[model samples]
Structure formats: C-alpha cells, structure tokens
Target: NNFIPFYFFVDVYHEGLQYYVIRSIGGNLILLLPVGLLFPLLFKKLNNVKRILLTGFFISLFIELAQLSISVYIRSVYRSFDVDDLILNTLGTVIGYWLFFILSMFYKRVTYRFKSNTSINIE
Candidate 1:
C-alpha cells in the first residue's frame, strides 16, 4: 500500500527508527543481489545490464503483488506493497551486475596474462 517511493525512508528518518530503515532498505536491496550475479552467469541471454534491470524490476513487482494478494486473501496486512522496494531492488541488481562485470574482466585479464606467459614454442 506504500506507493510513494522513499516514503518509508523519510518516515524512518523523522521518527529515528534506524532499525526499520536498515531492515527495510537493506533487506530489499540484498534480496535480489544474487539474482543479478547469477542470472547472467547462468543464462547466456542475460549477459547485459539492460536484461538484468528488466528482470529485477519484474521479479520485484511480482513479489510485491504476491504480498498484496496474500494480505487481501487473509484479511490482514501481512505485508504492504512499496514502490521503493522495486527501486532499491533494481538498483541492487545493477550493482550486482557491475560487480560480476568487474570480476569477469579481472579474471579474463589474469588468465590471458598467464596463458601468454606459459606459451610453449614447438621445435
């Protein structure tokens, strides 16, 4: 039910609820970090940042919608939908993608250097 993005951040800041801020923001961001790192590595088609972004957005949207559905079905607000979660989750995915990219680059550079150094000449 929290459609306003970053609203929780403002509320938590004003109320000095540091724990909620960390739990909500950090939890959402960390939730999808693995998705970003693994999707591209596992699927050749997801080897780009754009694909990661869209995938993250849709995944987060589905989670939020599911929560809303469960809350309605149970006649209780077990979890509320929040746009900020979508934003933060997507950001986390992008960050993960960048980390993967950097690591891949470093790996390639190291392997290439090792191969060149270990080249054997045929007589």
Candidate 2:
C-alpha cells in the first residue's frame, strides 16, 4: 500500500526495478550534470573515483529525502521511509559509473585498432 504522488511522472506499482532503471540513467546524469559542469574549476585536484562515488552517495540521499518530504506534502504518507532507497540509488550511480568506464575502455581499444590498421598516428 505504498503511496506515490500524481506528479511523480513514473508509476510506482510497476515494481522497484523501474525506479532503479529511471534513476540509474536519467537520475544519475541529472545528478552528475552539475558535478560535471563544476568539477573543472571546483575540484580539479580530486580523484575521479572518489568524487563520483562520494557525490553519488550524497545525491541518492538527497533523492530519498526529496521523496520522503514531497510524499509528506501530499499527506498520503503510505510509502515506507526506508534507508534501502538510499542504498539502491547510490549503488545505481556506481553501476552507471562502471558502465562509463567499460565503454571508454572499449572505445579506446577500438580506436587504437582502427588507427593502427589505417597507419594513422593517434599520438
């Protein structure tokens, strides 16, 4: 009997995995946009892994808090204010980050192969 507001844009009863999919891609990018825009000037010296993981954790916390608070405003109050969302969203972000790493690795390898095959100096 969990309550989700009308304006949440996505259906809640579809299962928790729906939220994971939405948050994993759209939410991660939404949350990362500011960090990506700001990182060059704000914290150029920080390591990428630590920055992504730590900020992603905070972003997940923020999402959970937003959901909790907004649901309160609707006064339906049926959703459980559980910590599990925080865990799942943050892990989703981490998974997205890993996906980025894997794609980049493949891109580099493919580009190297293409460049070598064509006798083009990529350096």
lDDT leader: 1
Ten contiguous residues with the weakest lDDT in model 1: 4-13
The top-ranked prediction according to TM-score is: 1
Per-model C-alpha lDDT, please? 0.90, 0.57
- Candidate 2 residue pairs in backbone clash: none
- Misplaced by over 4 Å in model 1 are none
Q: At residue 20, what lDDT does model 1 achieve?
A: 88
Error of 2 at 30 (Å): 14
lDDT for model 1 comes to: 0.90
For residues 1-123, could you state the per-residue lDDT of candidate 1 as single tens digits? 889888879987889888888888888888898888889999989899999999999999999999999999999999988899989999889888888899899999999999999999999
lDDT string for model 2 (4-121, tens) is 4322324442555566556544654454444433443356553265666777678766766777787788887645444545555556556655666566679899999998889856
Clash counts for the predictions, in order: 1, 0
Name the runs in model 2 displaced over 4 angstroms.
Answer: 1-47, 120-123
In candidate 1, which residue pairs get closer than 3 Å at backbone N, Cα or C atoms, i.e. clash?
1-81
